[model samples]
Target chain A: MTKKQLKNLALQSYTKDLLDQKKVESVARLLTRFQLKQYIRELRNSESQKTINIVLPHLPAKTDQQMLSRLFAGKRIIYHVDKTLLLGIKIIDNDQVYDLNLKDTLDNLFTFVSSGYD
Target chain B: MIDSQKIIEQLENRLMSFGVDKKTQNMGVVEKITDGVVIASGLSKCFMGEIVAFGNGNYGTVLNLDEDTVSIILLGKEGKLKEGDGIKRTGKLLSIDVADTILGRVIDPLGSPLDARPKIKGARAMPLERIAAGVVEREPVNTPLKTGLKAIDAIIPIGRGQRELIIGDRGLGKTAIAIDTIINQRVSNDVICVYVAIGQKQSTIAQIIDRLKEEQALPYTVVVVASSSDPASLQYLAPYAGCAIAEYFMEKGKDALVIYDDLTKHAWAYRQLSLVLRRPAGREAYPGDIFYLHSRLLERAVKLNKKHKGGSITALPIIETQANDISAYIPTNVISITDGQIYLEPDLFYSGIRPAVNVGRSVSRVGGAAQTSAIKSVSGKLRLELAQYRELAVFAQFGSELDATTMALLERGKRTTEILKQLQYQPLKESLQILSIWSVTNGFLDDIPVESTQRFEKEYHEFVSSRNPKLLETLETGEKPSEPTVTQMEKITREFKKIFSF
Candidate 1:
C-alpha cells in the first residue's frame, strides 16, 4: 500500500471503533475512491509543510451557552467534544501549539517508564 | 616570508581604525612573524589576532584573541595579526553558548556532542546562571517515584520532584542505580530521563550509551557528559546545562528526571574555574558559594502547581563521600539540600546488598505517600524485623542468643536480606516482582530456621515460579498485584513450607 493508504488505514483503525457502525459506513460512502485518494495525498503533503492545524476538545460538561460563545468569539479556533483527546484542548498552527488542556501535560509527564533509582 | 615591518604597519592601521591611542610601547624591535596569530612575551605572555573590525571606543571585539595568551571568538572577516606579534586584552572573558538541548545527548562540557550526532536542535539557548527555585513556588514532595528496587522503593522512597542525593564511596554502583532508574523509565514512556556524567571517564560514558542503546532506552533518555579531560569551564557548566534541558520538558508540563552521576567532580571543576577567575577559596580550597552552587542547581528541580500544568523536575544528585564520611563539606551540603538520601554502605555492599543501601538511616522524607498500598502495608514490618534481626544477630555473634523469638527474628532477617539482595543489572520490573513476592509471603517468614532461611527463600521462589508465572508479569508492568494473586502467592508459600518441612 502507498504511504497515504497506510496513514488512512492507521487513522481509520484508531478512530473507527469510536464512531457508530452506520455512521462510519455512511462516512466511508461519502468519500469515493478518488476522493479518498485525494484526501490521503493532502494529508501526506501537509505533514511535510512544517505547519499543522489542530482542533481542541471542549471542556467536559460545558454549557451550551458557553460553547456557543466560544465558537463565535471571532477567533479562528473551534472546540469539539471529542473524548479521545482526554480532558484538554490543543491548537496547532505554524510550528507552534497552544495547549489548553490538562490531559496533555499529565499524559506527557506520565509517559516516562524507566525503573532505576534516580 | 612576511616582513615584520608590513605586519606592524597592518597592526598599526587596524589599531587606528579602532580609534585606539596607540602608545607604540616598543618600536623597531623587529621580531620574526609567522601565521596570522602573533605571540610575543617579554614581561607576560601576549597574543594578538588579526583585527577583524573596529568596535566602539578604544575597545573592540577582535577577530581572534592571542592564541598563546587569550583565545578570541571572531565574527566576520577583515582581521590581521602575524605569527610573532603582541596584543593587549581589555581583561574580558570569552562567552560560550549554553542551551537546553545539551541534555540527554552525550556532549563535552563545552556543549559539543561527543556522540558524533548532529549538533543540538533546540531553538533557544541561554547563559549558565546559578538560580534557585523561589520559596513561594516550592512545594513539599508527596508523590512517590518508584525505582522498582524493593530496598530503595520501600525504605528510601524517592518522591517525584524531590532532589534525592545518592552518597557512597567510589565503585559502589552509584552510577548503576542512576542508569537503572533511567532505563526503568522505558516501562513508563511518560517519564523523560536525563543522565549527566561529571568528571567521568569517556570510555565509561561510551559504555553507558551502549547499554542504553542495547535496552532501546536512548530515544526518551539524554546523556550529558563532562569528562575529567574536558576543560574546567565545561565541567562548571555541565550540571546547569543538564538542568536547562530538564527545564524544557518541565516547563512544557512534562515530568523530567535528571541524574548528576556524581557532584564531587563538578564541585572540583568549579573550584578550578573559580581559582582561574580569581574567586576567593574557602574550606578545601573551594569557592565560598560551593554550598549555594549545589543548592541552586537542585532547587531548580521542582514540581509546579496543578494550575501551571503540574510539571515536575526530579533530580538525583549523586555525591561520593570520602571514606564514608558524610559530614564532609560537599556531602553535608548536598545532604541538606536534597529531599532525602540513599546512603550506600561499603559493609552492606560486602554483605551482598547489591544496592548497598543502608536502610537504617536512608530515607525519602515525602516518598511514603507514593508507594503502592501493598508495599506500604509490608514495608513498615519489614524494616522493623530487619532492625531487630540486626541487633539480635550482633548479640548472637558473641553467643548471647537464648530465646525462640530472637531466633525467629534472626531467621526472618536472613530471609529478608536474601530477598533484598538482588542481582546486578536486573531490570526494574524483575526487581519489583522479587520484592512484592517477599512482601506477601507470610508463611515463609513464620517458621523458617535462621541458618537455612536463605535456602528456604530460594526454594520458595522456585516453588512460586513453578506455581504461578503471572506474578512476574504483573510486577513487570508495575500494576498492583490483585487480591486473588496475593492469596495465590500466600497459598503457594504455605504449600511449599508444608511440603519441604525443615
Candidate 2:
C-alpha cells in the first residue's frame, strides 16, 4: 500500500482520547514489516508533538516545576538533566532549541569577543 | 598597534549591556559520514552556504539540502565527528575576515594565517559567495590593467574589472605570465592584488611567494592558498575567498586584481564535493552546476559606478588545459564567461617564444578601450605586420621562392616576433612598450638583422633612457603621439641606426 494510505490506516486506529489496542493490532497485521516500522515511527512523532522537553543542569524545585507545568498546560512536560549546560534551562520544542543555558551564553560571549578582538 | 584603551571601553559597554536570554538554534543530528561528507537530518531551517557549527572550532558549510537530509563537506582538519554528534546552525554565511593588514600574508580559505603570522586584526567579514554587483551598480570597463607584456598590452589587453582567462597546456609559462602581471602592479597603478592558489603543490606556491617577495611585490599582494593537501571544501572556497578579500579593498574605493591561478583544479574540487554528496553527476562526471560554479565566481568581477564606490576587481583566471585542447568542457565554459582570453600555445612556447601569446587567437572583447592612447596609436600596424608574417612564415616553411614585397613582409614579421618575445619577469613600462613597437612597425627595425634585433632593442632603450628622458616622460602622459614627437622618434631611430654596428 502507498504510504499515504498507510498513514490514513494508522490514523483511523486511534480512538478519541487514546489508541484502540485491538484496532491498532488489526491494522498492524495488514502492513508489511517495512510499512509497520514506518507506521510506528509516524505514531511516535505525532505523540512526541504533544510534549515539550526541558533540559537543565539539575532537577528543578517544586515551585519551578509548578511554574513550568502551568506555562505549558495540557501538554506533557519531560525534564532531562544534562550537566554540560552548567546552569539555566533549555526548552526543546520539536527541532528548535530555546537555549538559555550558561554554556551557550559563555560560548556566545567568547564568539563575540574573539570575532571582534582577535 | 592596537587601540587597547578604546577596546577596553567597548568591552565594558558590552559587559554592562550583557543579559542572559534564550537564543534559538535549529539543530540536526549527524546520520552518517560518507567520504568526509556529513549527512544530517532535521536542520530544516538551514540555508545553503550557511555554516554549521560542530563545536570545538570545527565547522562545515551546507552544500546540499534534500527533502530529508542535508550534506555538508567538513571544512578543516578536525574530522573525528561521531554518527550521533549534533550540529547546530550558526545563522552565519561563509565569509573571510579581511583587513588592510592582510596584505603580504599567506592565508587559507578560512582566512586563517598560514604564514606563521598573527591573525587578521579588527577586520570586517566579507561573504565569500556574494551576489555580484548588478547591472545598475556597474560601469563599463574603461581603465587599463596593464600586464606590461608587450603582446598582451598591444593585443589581448585586460581592463580594470575585466575577466581575462590565461589558458594553455602544462609548462608553457601560464603562471609566469600571471606572476609577471602581479609584479607589474608594483611599477604602476598601485592596484592591490590577491592570488588564489588552488590545488597547487606547496613547494610551487612557496617558490611563487619567494619570487613575489624577492621582487618586493608581496607587500601589495595577498596569497590565499588551498593547496592540494587540504580538503576539497577549502579548495572549492579558495577562489571565492580571494575574491572576497579583493572585494574588501575595492569596497574601500581601491582598485584590486584577483588571479585564480588555474581554475581547472577548482572544478575538480567541486566535482569531488558533489560526487561525495551523492549529487547526480552530469557531463564527464561533473555535477550539473559545473558551469555555474565558475560563472558565479567570475561574474563577481565588476567595475562599480561612482554613485557607489568607483572601485573595481579585475579577474585573471588561469586554466590549464590538457594537450592544448581549448574545446574541452571547462575551457569553453570559462572562455565564454570571460571578456576574452590570452591563448598561449605550446607550439609557440616550445619554439622559444617566451610568454608565447598567440595573438591571432587571443582577443580582448574590451579591446583598445583599456589600452592607453600611446600604445593604441602604434599597436595597429604591429598587429597587421605580425599577422602577415605569421601567414607568410608558413609558406616560407614550404621553401618556395617569394617576391620583394613578400620578402619585406617576412622580414618585418621576424623582427616583430623578436620584439614581442619577452623573457620571464621583465615586463616593460607602457611608453617603452610603445616606443619598441612603433620603431618596428614604422620600418625603422627592417634593416636590423633578426639575430641582432634584441640587442638593437636593448641599446635603443638605454639610448633613450640615458639621453631623452623628456620624450618618455611625454609618452607616459598617455597622449597620442604628436607630429613633432613622431618626427623626433624617426630622427632618433635614424641616428641610432647609423651609429650602431651589426
Candidate 3:
C-alpha cells in the first residue's frame, strides 16, 4: 500500500478506538503487538479512571501512600518494586509517566555538564 | 581531547550553583526502533522539538508527536535501543554552546571539539533553529564582502549581507571559490568565517582545514564538519549549527561569513530523515518542506540596521548541480532564495578559468553598491563589454569575416579574461585587484601579447608600489582615485612599458 493509504489505515484504527471505548480492549487484542500497545495507550488517554502503575526502588512510607492515593483519586493503583531506580519513584499512567529518581537526575546532570552549561 | 579534569571542576561549580528541587521527568517506553527513528509511547507530555534521552545513553530530538506515540530522530547511536526501553524528556530544545573560544576549533554539529583539543568553555548557547531576523531589524547591504577574485569582485559583487550561491557540477571548483573567499578574509580582522563541511569525505575536510591553517585563516575561522560517515541527523543539523555559531559573532556587532560547502548533501540528509519518519514525499521523493528548509536557513544571513549594531552574516552557500542543470530541484530552490549566484561552468573550468564563473549566468543583485569606489570606477562597463564580446566571439567561431571593432572587442575580452585568471588560494588584495583591472580597462595592455598579461600585471604592481606607494594607498582607501592620481598612474604605466621590452 502507498504511504498515504497506510496512514489512513492507522488513522481509522485510532478513530475506531475513540468512537467505541468498550470495544477498545477487544479490538486491541486483535491488533498486532505494536498496534495493540498504541491502541491501549490512545484509549487510556481518551477518558479518566486510568490504571496507574507505581514502581520504586524501596517501599514508600504510609504518609507517602496517602499522598499518592489522593493524587490519583479516580484511578486504580498497581504497585511494584524495581531496584534499578536506585532511589525515588516512577508513576506510570498509560501514556504519561512521572519519574522522580536520583538516577535520572544524575544522568541529566552528566549530560548537561558534558554538553557545556550555557 | 576533553579536559576531563577542568570539566569536572566546572561541573562541581555548577552543582554548587544549583538549588535543590523535586525533579520530575516525563517518561516514555520505546515501542519500536527503525532506521534511527524511535517510536515511543507514554510521552504524552513531551512537547515538539524537546530533547529526549534513551535508556541506552543516546539522545534524540522529538520530531513527530502523535495521539499515541512520539517519533524521535536519534542524534547519536541507535545500537542498543530496544522495544520497552525507557525514554525521558529533558524539557529542552537542541542547542550548541558558541563563544570566541570556539574560533580556531574544528567542531561537530553538537559543538564538541573534533580536533582532540580542549573542550570549549562557551559563554552562550545558540539554539539550532532560530527565527530569521525581521525586516525592521535589517538594513540595505552597502559594503562589499570581497572574495578577492577579479571575475567575482569586478562583476558579481557580493555585499556584506548578501546570500550569493556558488553553483556548478561536481568537482567544478565550487569549494575552491568558497575556500578562496575564506582565505581572503585573512586580510581583514573585522570579519570572522565559519566553514560548514556537510557530508564531505573526512580526507577532504582535513585537507581544507590544513589549507586554512597554512593560510593562517584558522585563527579567526570555525570549521564545522559532519562527514559522510556521520549519521544523517548530524549532517542535516550541520549548517544550522554553523549558522548559530556565526550568529553569536554577528549579534555581538561583528561581521561574519559562513560557507556551507555544498548543501546538496544537507538536503539529502534531510530527505533521508523525512523519509525515515514516513513523511509524504514531494517531487524527487523529497519532503514538501524541502524548500522551507533552505529558505529559513538562508534568510538568517542578514545585515542588521545601525540601531541593531549593524552586524551582518554574509552567506556563500554552494550547491552542486548535475550536468550544469540549474533547473534541478535543489539548485533552483537555492538560486531563488539567494540574493545572486556565481554560476561556474564545466566547460569554462576545463578551458583553464579557475573560478570558471559564467558571467552571463552569474550576477550580484547587490549591484554596484557592494563594490569599492576604486573597483566600481574601473568595472562600470566591464560586464556589458564582456557580454557583447561573448556574443560576437560565438559568431566569430564560425570563421566568418569580422569588423575591426569586433576584433578589438574579442582581443580586449581575451586580455580581460586572462587578467581575471587568479591562482588558487592566492587571493589578491583590493588594491592589487583595482590596479590590475585599471591597467586592462585603461588600454595599457592593448598592445601587450595576451599570453604575457599575467607577467605584465605582476611586474606592473611591483613597479608601481616601489615608485608611487601613494597610488596603492589611495586605492586601498576604497575611494575613487583623484584625477591627478589617475594621471600619475597612466604616466607610470607608459614609462614602465617603455623601460621593459616584451
Candidate 4:
C-alpha cells in the first residue's frame, strides 16, 4: 500500500520468522522497539495509496516463498522481466541493487568485436 | 685516603670490559679528595663532561667527563663521585633517531614530532650525516619549474629537477621566493614540497608557518626545522633529514621539491661537531669531508628514468653571501655543485626591486624548456631593455645628453623593477597583479604615470577579480595575453591613472 506499510510488514515478518526459527531470543532486545512500533503505526496509517513500479530483464531463480522470506529478512526488493536481460535476473531496491544477467556480461563484447573474433 | 693500587685496578678492569685499548688510554689523578676521584687527560679531550653509571643497572652517556687526571675521557655523573673515583671508558659515540614517518610532518632538530601528532609510522631511520647523491646516477635537469615570477620566469627560469642555489645577503627575499614556489605547487597535486630551515630564528620559522597556513600550503608541505637554538648535532642533521624524507616520495615516482632555507649554518654546525668529535680539520677549520658532505646531499636530488618511478627532487639551496661575495669558499663550493643560481643583488634590492634578482648574473641552467610562450616572448625584450637601462641610467646620472632611446630604456627599467617589487611574503596566486603590470609595461597602458603604479596594480586586480579570474591562471601558464584580457587590463590602468592623478 504505502512505502511505510511495506517497510513495517517486511520488518514484522522478518522478526516473526527469526522468532519462529529460534534465531533470536527476543526481537525487543535485538532492535529498537519504540522505533519499530512507530514505524508500524505510520505504515498502518499510510497504507492506502502508495505503490512502486520496477523493471527487470528476467525473473529470478528463487520461488515466491523464498522471495517473501528474503523480503521479510530486511531485503528491500523489486523485480520484472525483459528479454533484454537475456536469461539472467536483476533486482533493484532502496540503495541496494543486484544484477546477475547476460546483458551486463555482453557489454564488454565490443573489445572482442573489434578484434574480429567472437 | 684511598689506595692508588685499588683505584688503578678498578679503572683497568672497567676499561678492559668497555673495549678500550690501553695504548689509546692514558690516566692521571686529579685532587684525591675524600669525596671522589676527578681525572683529566689529553685522550679525554672530546669526551669531557660525559658521565657513565654502572653496577646499579642504569647506563647513561657521560655528560661531564673530566680529562685532567685520566688519559681517557672521564665518565661519571656530576654528584655521583665519592673519594676513590674509578674511571671507565665507553667507546660508543652518540647517535640520532631517523625514521620514515618523519616526512610530510614538521619536526624539531632532535627528530621529535612538532605537529603534536603521534610518532611517525615508518620504521627505518638513519643518522643525519648521510652521503650526497652520486654523480653517475643523477640525470641532468631538463624539466622546468615555473615560479610564476615574470622577471625570473622570463629571464632566469628554474627547471623542474634543477638544483638552483639562491644566494643573497640576509634580510633579502631568498626564503620568500622559495616559500612562494611552494605555494604555487598547491594547485598541482603532483608536486610535493619540503622546506628545511637550518639555523634560522624560531620566530621566523613561526612566521613562515603562519604564511603557509594563510595560503593553505601546509597540507602538501613538510617542514624540517633545525633552528639556531638547536644542538649542533641537530643543525648538522637538518638537511640530510630533509633529503631522506624527500627520498621516500621520490621512490614513489612522484615529483618533489625541497628547499634548504640556508646551508651555511648547517656547514658551520657540522664543522663544529666534527672538531668536537676529533675529526681532522681542513680549510677554514672545517672537516676534510666538507665538500663530500655537500656533494652527497645534492646528489640525492635526481629525476628518475621511466622504468623506475618517474620522480624528481628539485633542490633550492639558499646561501647567504657576506658583502655579496660569491667567491667565498662555501658559496663557490655550493655554486659548483648546483645546476645554476638565482643571484639577488643588495644594490638592486635597495633600489626598490623586491626580489632584487640580478638578471645579468643570475642564470637557470635548464629552465629554457619550462618557459611559457608568453614569458619567452616578453622576457627576450625585457632583459635587453633592462641591460641598456642600467648603462643609460648610469650615464643619465652623469649629466650627459640623453637620447629618446635611453629615456625609453630608463622608463622600461623602472617599470620592470616596479613589476617585480612584490610585497614580502605574499603568495604567488597574487601574480595576476604582476601580469597586469606586465601588460602596462608592454605599451598596453604606457600613459600611466610613475606614482600611479600601486594604485593601477590594485585596480587592475580588482577588475580581473570581478570579470574573468581564469585569465590569471592562463597568464601564469605563459599563454599570450588574450585580446579581451589585454583590453580589460588597459581600461582599468587608464581609469586608475585618471583617478590617482586627480
State in Å the error of residue B365, model 1: 1.3
TM-score each candidate.
Answer: 0.62, 0.90, 0.90, 0.62
Candidate 4, residues B79-101, lDDT tens digits: the string is 45343343334344433344445
DockQ of each: 0.00, 0.50, 0.36, 0.00
Chain B TM-score by candidate, in order shown: 0.75, 0.96, 0.96, 0.75
Task: Give the Cα-based TM-score of candidate 2 against the true structure.
Answer: 0.90
Model 4 B-chain TM: 0.75
Between prediction 2 and prediction 3, the one with superior DockQ is 2
Top candidate when judged by DockQ against the true structure: 2
lDDT of 2 by residue, B1-502 (tens): 8799988998987677565353988978787887668888668899998999885568998988886578988888646788878888988899998999999999999999999988998789999998899999999999999888999998788999999999999899989999999999988846999999999999999999999999899999999999999988899999999999999998888899999987999999999999998889998999999999999999999999998889999999999999889999999999999999999998899888888999999989999999889889999888888888988999999989999999999999999999999978888888889889999998888888999988999899888887788889988888999999988888887888888889
Q: Per-residue alpha-carbon lDDT of model 3 for A31-72, expressed as tens digits?
A: 677666545554444432256789999888899888999998
Alpha carbon deviation, residue A19, candidate 2 (Å): 9.6
Local distance difference test scores for all models: 0.63, 0.89, 0.86, 0.63
